[model samples]
Target chain A: MSETDARPGYFGRFGGQFVPEALSGAITQLEEAWRDAEADPTFGLELDRLRSQYGGRPTPLYLAERLSEEAGLEVHLKREDLAHTGSHKLNNVVGQALLTTRMGKPRVIAETGAGQHGVATATAAALFGLECVVYMGAEDCRRQRLNVVRMQLLGAEVVPVESGTRTLKDAINEAMRDWVTNVDSTHYLIGSAMGPHPFPLIVRELQKVISVESKAQFAAQAGGLPDAVIACVGGGSNAIGSFAEFIDEPDVQLVGVEAAGEGIGTGRTAATITEGREAVLHGARSIALVDEDGQVKHAHSISAGLDYPGVGPEHAMLADSGRGRYVAATDREAIQGFRRLSELEGIIPALEPSHAIGWLLAHGRDELDAGATVILTVSGRGDKDVDEVVKVMTELGIAGDLGNEVVDADPREDPESDA
Target chain B: MSAVTDAFTRARDEGRAALVIYLPAGFPDMETSRACLEAAADSGADVLEVGFPFSDPMMDGPIIQAASQQALDHGYGVADDLDMCRSLTGEVDVPALVMTYVTIPDTRGFARFADEAAGAGLAGAILPDLPAGESDPWVREARRTGLDTVFLASSVSTDDRIDRIAEVSTGFVYAVGLMGVTGVKDVASDDSRTLVERIRSRTSTPVAVGLGVKTRQQAAEVASFADGVIVGSAVVQAASDGEPAGAAHRVADLVRELRAGVGSR
Candidate 1:
C-alpha cells in the first residue's frame, strides 16, 4: 500500500473517517497511539510474544490433499481455526487489547455478528484485566447463543442491540454510540479491517501476521510461493490479512469469496464487493449493499459473521485497482463446503471461510491452472456453527445426503412465518 | 449573509438565542412531517432543520433513530427531503436547512446534490458525520451552490480543530452539548457552556448547542450561553407521542415552550 493510502485513511477514494465529531478526539488519539506503537520495537516484541505464547501463532499451513484432489489443484489451508478463541479474530483483539492498555484506556467496547469477534475480544479483555462490553444484534444473540454465552463467560457484558435490522450493522451502530459516549475512558476495539482510517490500518497490520507467516511457511513447505491466496471477505479482515503480505507480489492472485446468501439476484446477500455500490457505511467509504437512493440495505447470510452490508474500504480499493478478484458463494454452496471440509480434511471450518472453500470447489479449475497451488485461510473453526448447520440441513431436506444436488432454498425465508 | 446566518443574526439582534427545531422529513409520513415543520415554523422557530432519514443514523439516539427508521419505511428519499425543504421554506418565513448523514449527498454526487438542494430553496445543510478534515470537497460543492455548510464541534474538540471547523463553517458552528448522540438528557451539560466559550474565543461565528436539549428548562439553560439552542429528539418525541391527529399541535406546543424558554434568557 502507498503511504498516501495509509495516511488519513483514504485508499484510492474509498476510506476516510466519516464519524461524528464526538468521537474525533478519540480517533485522533488512537491514530497517534497506533503510529507510536508501530514505530516502537518493544510494541512489536510484546505483540509477537502475545501471538506465539497466547494466540498460538505460526498456525500451520497444511496441504489438504483430499480437498486438493476435489478442487483439481493443490490446496493448502492456513489454519487460523487453530488460533485461540477458535478464529482468526483473536489476532485482532489481542493487538487492540494491548493498544487499549498502551493508550491507558481501562474499558473496551466492540460489535459482533457471529460473536467470534466478541468472544475473541472478551477473551483478550479477560487476559488483560480490562473491562469489556460487546454489542450484538438481538437477532444474532438468538442465532449465536453459544458464542453469546462464551462472551458472558469470558466476563464481557453483551448488549443485544434491538434497533435497525437487529444484526451486525445495528450492533456496529450501537457500539459506535457507546464509544462516542464513553470515549474518554473506553476504546472501541473494532473487529474488522473496516470502519474509519486507523481501524482498517490497525486491524490489517495486526492480522497481517497470517500472510507474514504463511508466505514463509508456504515457501519452505512447497518449495515456492502459491499461485493464489484465497479467503472469505466479511468486512475483509481475514481476507486482507491472508492477502496483505502477498499484495505486493504480482503473480499471486488474491481471491476474496463473499457470501451470496441465497443468491445475489434474490436481493438477499452479503456479497458487498460483488453486488454492492460505492457508499459510506459505519464510518468509512466502502462498497455497501444500498438501495438506488443510497440507503444501506439489510445483508443476509447463513453465517452471521458474513452478514454485513459493507466490505472493508481497502477491498474496494483493491478491487478497483484489479489487485484483487472477488467472487460469491451461496448458502447451499457454503454448507456443502462446510460439510466437505469436515469430511475430507477432518476440519470443521467456520461458515465465513467455507465460502472460500465453496467458491474454490465450484470455480477453482476455471480460475487456476490444473496443478497450480492455492493457499486458503480457514478463518475459524466451526464448532459454533454445528447446531445451525444441522438445522439448515434438515430444513433443506439434505440432512443425510452429502451427494445431493444444490438446493434452491432461500435460507432467509421463514417457512414457519408463512405457515 | 446566507439565510441561516441571517436567521442567527436576526435572533441575536432580537436579544435572544435562535430556536432551531429539527424534524425528520417524511417521519410517520410525509404529510404529517410537513405539518409538524409548519407548526414548528409558525410557533416561533427561527430556523427549521428538515432531517433526511437514513438507514443507519449512528450519531442519533433512540428517538431520532426510530423516527428515521419510520421515515425510511415510508419510502422517504433525498428528493422527498428536498421537496419538504422547498415547501417549508416557501410556506413559512423561517430558514430551512437539510440535516442528514454525508453518504446520502455523497452518493447522489456532492455537486449535484448541492445544486438540487439549493434549487429546492434549502438554506444549507448540517452533516453531523462530516468533520472539517474531510469536508473540503463538500465545502467546495456547497460553496459553489451558494449553500451554507454547518459543521459540528464537540466538547472534546481541541482549539486547533475548533478553528478549522469555524473557518469552514458558513452557517453557525454546531456545538454538540454533550459527548453523546442526539437525545434528551435530564441535566444540561456545563461542558457545552465551556465549549461555546472556547469556540467564541477562537472565532466570531455564531455557535448553536445541540444533541441533548429536550425540555424548556434545558433549552433556556443552553440559550443562556449559546447563540442557538437546537431541539431534535424531543420534538420528534412530541410528534410521535399520542395520536397522529394531534401531532402537529403537540409539536407546535413544544416548540412554543422551547421558544419561550430561549427568549427568557
Candidate 2:
C-alpha cells in the first residue's frame, strides 16, 4: 500500500501487507486513498498547514549547554518536549487520527501503559471528533493519576482493566479483547508496533514520520547520519521510529536503552532484549522475560514508561537477527543523569529517555566520536517525571526536598484538576 | 463407512459404550498433543474430537480456554492446525473427528476444509456454531468428500432442530449432557436421562450423550436411554492429572471405571 515499498516487504520481516480478512473491504479503500494522497503535492502542504495553523510545527532544537559543560560533550536536544501535550507521541497519534477519518473508522480504542498514549489517543479523538475509549491497567490508573485525569478531561472514557498482573500487559489484552468483540466499528490505535500480523508493520509506518523529520533536521545540522542513535524502549516505538531509517545504512549504529531497574542480573529489570529469553507473546515471535513455565514476568523500572517486561516484535527480531544492539541502564544511573542534566543543562529530560542519556553518559564522553553527532530521541518532556525525579533523588541522598523548587518536593497537582 | 454410520454400528454391535474424548491440538506442544490423541484412541475411545481453539470460544469454560491459550502460545497456526488430525493415523484405533467452533471451518474455507479434513484422515467435524439452515452446504460438501458432519444437539435446541440435526448428522447422535461447558458431571443424573429421551424420539441412529459424564454410574444411567455414552472433560482431566506416563494410566483407569459402570447400569 506504500509507494516506497516497490520491493516486496519492508526490510524483510519488518513490513507486510497482512490484514484480517474482515478488514479486507475497509483496508482496500484505505490503501487506495493513502497511496493517492501520498502522491499528491498538496498532501504535505495541507499537513504542514494543519500542523502550523491547527497544530504546531518545528518544536525546538536546544543545545544543553549546562549539561554539556559538566559532561564535557555538547548535547543538542530536539524539543518535541515543547510540542502540544508534551511528547513525541503526538507526532504519530495525530497522523494516525487523520488516517482514521480518511479510512472512515468513526471510533478508536487505545491501550495505555503509563497513560501517555492514553492522553495522546484522547487528544486525537477530541481533535477528530471521534468517540474514544482508553483502556488502562488498574495499577497504571493509580500510578499515573495525572494522565488519567488528562485523558478524562479530554473527553475519553477511561476503562480500568483488572486482569492479569493489573498493568499495561493486561490493559493491552483487555483492549485487544474489546477490539475483537467490537471489530465492526473500532480502529485499534495501537500505541506501539506489536501484536499480530500487520499491526507491528502498520504502527511502525505511522511512527516513522517522526524520524523522517529528525533525519532531515540532523542532516541539515551535521551533514550526515549521527554516529549512534539512542532511545528508550518500553514498547520500543520511539527507538524503532528513529533507528528504522538507518537500519540498512551500515555505518550508523542504533542503540536501544532499556531500564535495568536495580540491574538485569538481579532479575528485576525491564531489559526485554537483555534479560528476556526468546518466546512468543502478545501475538508474534518475540523475547519476553518469562519464567520457565511460560508465565510473563512482571517488569520493574523507575519510570512508569519503561516498566514493560517485553517489547514490540520488530525490536525482538532486530535484536535476534543482530541488526541492532540493546543495552541496559540502572535506575540509579538514570537518576544521576536526571539530576546531572537538570543541574547542568537547565532542561529536564523525560525519565524514560533519561535512561538512554544515562547510558551514553556513563560510557563516557570519550566513547563518542569527535564531530560525530548522536541523536537521542527526546521522546517526552520531563514535566510528568519531575515529581518522581525529586522523590528518587531525595531517596538517593543527593538532594533534600528543597522547598518548592525541588523536583520531588513539589506537591503533585490535585488529581481532579483539568490542566 | 460414514463416520456417523460407523459410530451407530459400533454402538449397536459392540454393545460397548462409546467414549468421546476431546483435546485441544497443540496443547503443551505438538508432540504432546499427538501423544494425547494417540493415547485417547488407544484407551478404547470410540470417537476423538480434537478441539480447534478460537480466541473467542463462546460455549467453552475456563479449562478448555486455558488449554487453548497454552497451545496458541507455542506457535500453532491455522493452516498447520487443521492438518493435525493426521496425528491419529497409526495409533487411531478409533474414528477421529475435529470439534471446532464453526468459525474455523468457515474462515479456513468450507469446501477446502471439508476436502482437506477428509484427506488428512479426519472422519468428521462437530461444529457447534453451524445451525442446520447454514449447515446444509457444509454437510453436503462433507458428504461428497466422504467426511462426516456431526452436529451438536444442545439441551436448549427446539424439538424441530433435533429432527433436522439428526437428519444431516451422519455420526451417532451427540446429545449434550450438561447445560454449560465441557467438564465432569454426574453421569446418570436426571438431566442426562431427560436429554437422552429427547434425542431418542428424533432419530433411529444410536444416540450418545457427551459433556460431563464423569463417573461410570452416570455413564450407566446415560447409557439407559442413549445407546452410547460420550465422555470428554473427564478424559482431559485424567490426561492432564500428572506426568505423561501417568496420563495414559489415569485415562485407562477412568475408562475402566466408565465401562464397568455402564455395563452394570
Q: Against the true structure, what is each candidate's TM-score?
A: 0.96, 0.62
DockQ of 1: 0.79
Winner by lDDT = 1
- DockQ by candidate, in order: 0.79, 0.05
The docking category that best describes candidate 1 is: medium
Q: Candidate 2 on B1-265: residue-level lDDT in tens?
A: 6765675576557665666667788775667777777766675566778877665443444466567766766767655666677756545767788877654565456788788788778888887655563466688788888887776675556677678878987777777665445562343357667766887777777678877677777777776667777776676676777876666567677877876765554
True contacts kept of each: 0.76, 0.00
Local error of candidate 1 at residue A249 (angstroms): 0.8
Collision pairs in model 1: none
- Model 1 per-residue lDDT tens digits across residues B42-127: 99999999999999999988999999998888877888878877877778888888999998998888989999899988889999
